[model samples]
Target chain A: MAAPPPAAAATTRTGALTVGLSPYTARTSAFRRAQICRHRLPTLRCRRAQPLTAAASSSPVFHGECFVVGENIDTDQIIPAEHLTLVPSKADEYRKLGSFAFSGLPSAAYPTPFVAPGEESSRYAVIVGGPNFGCGSSREHAPVALGAAGARAVVAESYARIFFRNSVATGEVYPLELAEAGAWKECKTGDIVTVDIGKAVMINHTSGKEYKLKPIGDAGPVVEAGGIFAYARKTGMIASKASA
Target chain B: MTMTEKILARASERASLEPGENVWVDVDVLMTHDVCGPGTIGIFKKEFGEDAKVWDREKVVIIPDHYIFTSDERANRNVDILRDFCMEQKIKYFYDIKDLSDFKANPDYKGVCHVALAQEGHCRPGEVLLGTDSHTCNAGAFGQFATGIGNTDAGFVLGTGKALLKVPPTIRFVLDGEMPPYLLAKDLILQIIGEISVSGATYKSMEFVGSTIESLNMEERMTLCNMVIEAGGKNGVVPADETTFKYLEGKTSVGYEPVYSDAQARFVSDYHFDVSKLEPVVAKPHSPDNRALARECKDVKIDRVYIGSCTGGKIEDFLAAAKVFFASGKKVKVPTFLVPATQKVWMDVYGLSVPEFGGKTCSQIFEEAGCDTPASPSCGACLGGPRDTYARMNEPMVCVSTTNRNFPGRMGHKEGQIYLASPYTAAASALTGYVTDPRDFLM
Candidate 1:
């Protein structure tokens, strides 16, 4: 598949700052303050409050420090049922859900946490996770929370069907599969990594190593269009916003 | 073609379908409950316009189940959203609970959406169902293509009356031989999840066949299909047979064209199990795939026994639990909480008398065994709703529950340990205060 153009639809939808940036380009010149109004990654160190929120889309490339997690990270661990009461459709509740993302993961095991206490968004731009990453419940809030938390993408060995679909359907995160299994085992949380969706490569800058990713195939176009709704409008499969 | 392929083809108006091919299909029924309904409704209004009506009011089902009885203000308010949507659209099936103070006052109340779906006849063969909740796969027992979708997909379906779906390759499980009296469908599913691990069937369809599945009744078949999500399966189905036809007789007047897998059907893989040889089992703490036979875990003590959920809290589940409680003639060693799946099952516990027990109701037997009165249904404590949900694990106590999924913190407390067991094993464990085998009482 070819590289996606800048995500105008996504930018307007969530006001997220991810520009699908190129890792090779100099940040001072190519990377604008991206202002990242909301959902900026914890690693971006954006001090500005009330930033835009949106995830890393398939608009070619984006890189950031990773948030590492273990196997069987079910939806409960992603966004616990208690917090599921907050609807993702409403902007305020969507942000509230992000604050509580990964609240269900046992605190003893995951001491660092996905969203720090009293913090609105995560510092990590991407999630490096193990197998069965989003197992258990079919709550779409799991991915929506991560995207709302400003996490752009997830690289995992495997994913639950519903979680995978929800990620693509919401266009919240780039759910990528690792071609080199257990690649995440070598990296820890806060490891800087660059994801090139066009080339299907994930470069771990902290380790100075690069890993391969499985092509997302047919689902790629839908995600790039900012989920099924946008894709439907784009392809004329459904009526456009103006007509509706 | 596989049954799933056939169903998809029929829904999509295609002559054939392959596993990887994406196609658009008409959604027969789209069910949502309080937990996900508000979000789904919000999205529908946002995308389809505030004044836009659903594609078909009759095809949308709103059941207030997950947070129905909770006192949490937001959870309570979610139901009101569904009420307003149903009222505005004039939806055909809106199982609303108007009186939280008295469930009896609301005759339309149905506890769990999945079970209520079967009871209310929203589930039919050769049809397609997409719900906001994952357990929507529970409707696949009638040989339909039923699977769970996220609120986004459901919202889109609500507005468009169709969804883009990929046909999943089928994995056939042939369970032959007679089921032992002590064994329940819960044990069988636990065994499958154990062997296949949870992700074994990911992005695939699981089709059940053979003598053992044939011998099972409609409710038992539902139990098998309900946990397909646990295996990461898109759906699980049993071919529509007399049992399914009989169950649908009074439930729906709408005629459905039930389809069967062709003789030349191709399966991705196949598994065979002899139900007679399979022992009662449980999925222990933090994972549904962590399986251990009931007898193998007999030394592990527990603090509670909960019998409920779309997976196990049926009329038959209560009957099976009562059988053990009656046979033991002993008081429960720990707190044994009973929750029927739906209001009808609750009514059954109180109204229906067991013939083998000489006409004593399950409630009588449960009371005689020192168990808590069967609690009002509505998915109580299954996913650990608001802190006040009935029978929710408030502490880090070990529990033997008939419900599905032992994922950490699933019931309530993050440290709580859960053992997923059948009603028979759950009852016997309640008597022994450990993971006791039902054969000890059943035999």
Candidate 2:
């Protein structure tokens, strides 16, 4: 396919940026254009610049610092019931919402805050957890809190089913199940990691090792569309499919 | 197919069912409480736009149970948001706070979502019920396929009145043999969870069967199904029997088709337990699956005892605890909180013109035993409500409770050690200030 015009390229790069599409082919309506970008551009800039597009990307890749967490890190520990209603009705109040992330965790449980106060600006793209991560309550606030606190994805040995679905449906955090046993042990806090959703692979850049992830199946499209609502809107399942 | 599979198939309008097959099932009732309701409403408006109307207002139930008693502006603000949404949407089933004059007044509240949903007949046989709270599985006692979903999914259901569900495999649990008087259904479920571990039945259905389960009343059956989520089960179902029908009689006019599993239906795993071998069990702190017999934890001292929640705050539970307290003939040795799950349950406990109480209710019985009965029928201290909640722990204290989860910080303090037990065990522990077996008090 021919390269798009520079104006179109700029628009695609900055506007209507769907997942897995390179800025060069942004105007192309063909689904195969996303596939082409996936194989050609190993280090894609789309996800890093636009996190919203990461969910529906044909080949979504996320790179970030890992925050190692232990098994059964429940919803209450992530964001306690006390802070559940801290949700902001407007964008300006998000910092207040993010401030309470992991506030519920006892100081003795972690050496430092999961996301320290005033450090919400610092990006912690990935959360690495042990078995049965997000085991308690079905509050989507756990993942919502993490997303607002600047997490792009989570790599865990296993996840509680409700948390896994909530993460996908909210398009808040990409939940990647680590297929390799003890894979999380190889990485430490502050270690940089890269997750390739299409290939189902995780590369720990700090440890210089690669780990496999379980296949996400049909749920991938829903996540890519930035949640079930977006997917339904795009597919004309509900009315007002054209509007955002 | 199992009863769960059959229910799913009928809701999805399918002739047969297969595990892991995603099908869109029509929802009979969708419930959301204060904590998750505002978020669901936000997503609903964002996805469907401001003008979009809910699929069916009558089918949606909104109960403001959690965090409603708090003076905190944010908690009260959540209820206001839900109230406004109900007013805007013209939804009639919104159970609002009845008495604003006193937060403790067992106001005109319906109760905890799970308990009220069943008690009010929203959970019908062969139907599908969804709630934003995880304990929504408590509705499975009525032989329905009930499960919890997130705010986004709930929002979708609000617009579509349907949810796409993957039919989960079923695990059969059969309780046989004679029952011991001291052991409640809570003990039996705790033992089952202990054996199964926390995630033993993740994404699967649990069907309780056999003569022992058959003998349990509707409330006992609800207690059995309420904690299935603790075991990572999608739902816990009991086949609708005469007891189920009797409970539903005159409560609802909505028609329902009872579902039952074929005699030879296959289950992924089957477990048989004899009630005779069971003892009063308590799930120790940090995890609901970490369980031991009440006698095993007898040495552990307790600072408080709580008898309430969707799991343990029902009328039957109150009666069970009252029986122990009446027998002890002593004031509560430790600070104890007595919460009835619903206003109806509260009225029953207080003997408020209830003929069955014979002029003496469990609340009166507990008052004589020096227990603090919070008048309002909300989720008091179950989800660790306001700071002044009746059973909230301020420091690293141990509490034997009749609630479901025993996770860290689940009941106010992170260091608080919570032991999950039946109301009988909770009442006995309240009298002794330690984790004592109910049998000791009864004997």
Candidate 3:
């Protein structure tokens, strides 16, 4: 691995601060005093890390143009329930993934949004729909399937309340609000848009309009790393040393 | 701007938005059932790789409601796969048709997550919730924002615990006058959807207001909120109040907490409706969006009446059907089947109070009539159940069902026409064998 960057080392030291490592020791191993003396910072203070801490994760950040769609698309249309059974394994191994999962996607994959059984579609990372994006049952698999298809966020006129929360609770999908879809008509699916979760901002390249949104409660870490799983791993490694 | 736009704006703390944007938002809870989990697992593996741990498995929920009985070998395999996956993941909440201790562990499991969450406490006022099914919006009855997603979304949430959201315009359904007796929210929503067409309110938030809405019980309001999607709205909101809190009290985990819209809460566009003057409504076959009055096309003949679904399987809905059936006493022209949404509902109506399956208690009235014979309490052949199929192609078989949709082939063959109505109307039709309105029987 490449040598850790100064910023990366600084963050590591800050992380160690919460678990009770002295800043001096955090800068260098106890057995390596010369190295520790060279890197120790005098001003840093140790304190318990904040609950639901935010961290940079390895997941890729999605920022590009934007797209839009109409509303009230039911779960069946997203990833039809009938198709749920065709996956190769209970664990999803040996199955074709991506836009092919749903009938809808760029033509490059499945080429058709509605295919007979055994057909698939291309996958899109972001789906910008009109209001009531998910307005059906309490099926968590909807968002899960959407996430697995590579959707990082769903910018819509609005979300079904249940779908909105479920998306966040499970996959950390960004539920951005577009008061109206006028700008959406100007955009199309696959259009790139910049989604900055830290600022809760979405800049539609097509319209040049910037929209603000609500962040997941204490989800800064999850969004920064592109999602929660990435954050958990980083947190797990840090917590391990504290235990030791 | 429409009512959907305004409702979204009021709920929004962030700046105004345009479609095609993305941003993160807080998610109060995540819910899933086994009906479509296998698809999610498949996608998770493909995208994140097999070795990745399911992040935040505690927040994840999985229930085997769709084919809990496993009608065939393929179905059984589906259930088995989910069971094994949950075991490997060490998932905490798993409910089978036979083992339902988790319901009580909830201290207030109303049945399905849509209703159960509102009753149990996972859905709080002014919060966002998502589920894999359309009825997930039922929590909106409690003033929380809720909607349904799909399997891809579910898979992502399960793997990463994140989701994307979009803001929508708002459409206001203003109500006036009194709700006709026995008319209930189901009938009213059918009327609204008919006026707006199946996709009329597409991509918008529906804020139900007016004296009529204000007067409804939480159960009735939930019926309205749950069907917002049937009309194509993203989500529906009922401002919390005394009735809201009162209904939520004792029945849910977050009991007696009052919530409401701000006095200066914003709105998009508002429309008005007079329920008292409304007639019994019906949606023609092949589309839940195709609606008309029961009297406009009473000439249509019928073959079956299905009275059950998350929308129509509630105790109140059951009671409504029973009253209509008992009063008529005479079994009419068409065959009828009552499919409850969950086993608990089946037991509630059958009068069997067993403690093992959520609530062992059954509804004596229904049980006495052999109501539990439908096999399972979910989307069972309701999507194509045998009892509710069309006799022949081009044959007119009218069905009064409490199920959410009335699309062609939804119950059986696509050629047959299906009429959507409340349990009351369903029971009435089951007796008359022809299209009959509940009001006609009342007099």
Candidate 4:
């Protein structure tokens, strides 16, 4: 049988579908294509993109770094069931998940069995992680919690595709390109790492080298609009102002 | 492509679903327990409010299993909110803790939806079901497709009665022989997960076939189906057969619509396991995927040994444990906890002392052997009740339980290790203070 032509591939990669004809396929028969297309890889980022706004600059850019030690850190570690009972709104949800680190909590007051605690790492803007970062169930809460905990970006050798997408989609948990995450494992938790997410650059203060990172796709819009809620609010404000 | 890929390929309404392809699926049923109900309904109310009446109320089931007895005001409020919500919506199956008495009055109640639905005839073979709780896949025993979803997804289903589902491909498990006398369905699943690793079945639908599933009673069948998620597969199933028909005969009473795989049906991947030669398997602490033989399990000192869940809290499960207790005529080395998955099982099938080996109801026998009262509000510790972790670390305790997913810090403590096993194996381990095969107690 002849190899079928490439299916439709969508343009702009906003969870859209686009199909392209392959060189070898027959002209008359149908390929029955799925329009849902993923982004070009290695450079694949989250689904939103916008520019850095003035308000973001005023924050002075929170910057610090730490390492997530293990692989397959699931959503439960970031948020426990006990905390869900307390809050009703989605805005407060991330706060609960971020506060309940399972082990190695940077603070003495918070001692949970699962999270690792050291050097207020959660307060850091950049998180240097090991292999298979965020490998487990697809709880968008993991990224939500990390972002609420003040993690501006996650720099790992590799990331679970779903977590990577969710982090970027939410305009937080930025995935950075760290070809060798192991090398940075030795970097202390409080080490500072300068991040220019737009430039996809990370300067490890201790190592004094600029490490390349993947820009969170599409998420630029949400980040520019100040997170998903902020983005929604801004859009609403624009729509209301325009209607008036 | 893997077995999972093939299964998904066959199931996809779309032609081909490459990796990372997101496609929507047509759903069959949506279910939730009271734990998720508060949040799920809250979201639904915020999103749709009174307009939530579009979805068929009969299709939704709200069970109050978690936090039924904590007497915590929050827990009470959660339960009350779901009760009122279900009433307002005219939801058909709103099972409360007190409903345990109704099921006890009628032994047909079985246990969690995994067992109860089979007895009630709600889950037919070859159908798909979606539930808010991860273990909801337990409905796969009767060969139905099932999985767990989040509160938001469930809320979506509750409001629109539809979801954006991507049909998961199928992985076929072929069981070849009759189960050894000591080994049962739980071992079969444990062995499968142990072989494939924790994430092996991730994003796949598991289909169990062969002689082993054929020989299993619906209860035993539910045990295997309930644990499919441990393999990373969201749903597990066995095609409906004579066993299924016989089991469902009077319970559901609906006109039978038998669904089956075609004789020429294809599977993405095929797995073969011999049940006859198998010994009991145990998953060591921190991960249900962690596996070892009953005898090979070192004397992991015990803090608690819980034997109940949709997986192991059936009548047969209770009977299996009782047999071991009778055979040993001794108290367990540590706290041997037994929370019958359903009140029906607890009141009628279990909770009695037989008088032979001290003749206690299985619950009483367990109590004598150091078990606690059935957790007040429902399947408590199994779903994160306060009992899972020891009060303090350095407590030096290992809990041999039948609950799914023994991941690290799962039982609320990193130090606590949970061993997953059949009820029989758990009882034997409890008696010996070390992992012991059920066959040893058979003599």
In model 4 chain A, the worst 10-residue window by lDDT is A27-36
A best-first ranking of the candidates according to their lDDT comes to: 1, 2, 4, 3
What is candidate 2's TM-score against the reference? 0.90
Tens-digit lDDT track for model 2 on A179-244? 977788777887767777887887777777889999877777676666776666567765534433
Model 3: native contacts recovered, as a fraction: 0.26
RMSD of 3: 13.6
- By DockQ, the best candidate is 1
Model 3 ranges off by over 4 Å: A1-84, A88-244, B1-22, B44-58, B88-92, B98-112, B251-259, B352-375, B385-398
DockQ-based CAPRI category assigned to the predicted complex of candidate 3: incorrect
Residue B167, model 2: Cα distance from true site in angstroms: 0.3
Give one digit per residue, the lDDT tens place, for model 4 in B315-371: 778778877877777777766766676766667445455666555666666556665
Error of 4 at A186 (Å): 7.1
Q: What is the TM-score of chain A in candidate 1?
A: 0.78
Fnat per predicted structure, each in turn: 0.68, 0.44, 0.26, 0.05
lDDT of 4 at B184: 76
Question: Which docking class does model 1 fall in?
Answer: medium
lDDT of 4 by residue, A1-244 (tens): 1211111112122321222211111110011011002112111112112233553332222234444444444444455444434333343443445555444222232232222343212444456665556544444456655655555567776664445545654444566656454655655555556566656666666666666666555555555443433454466732211100
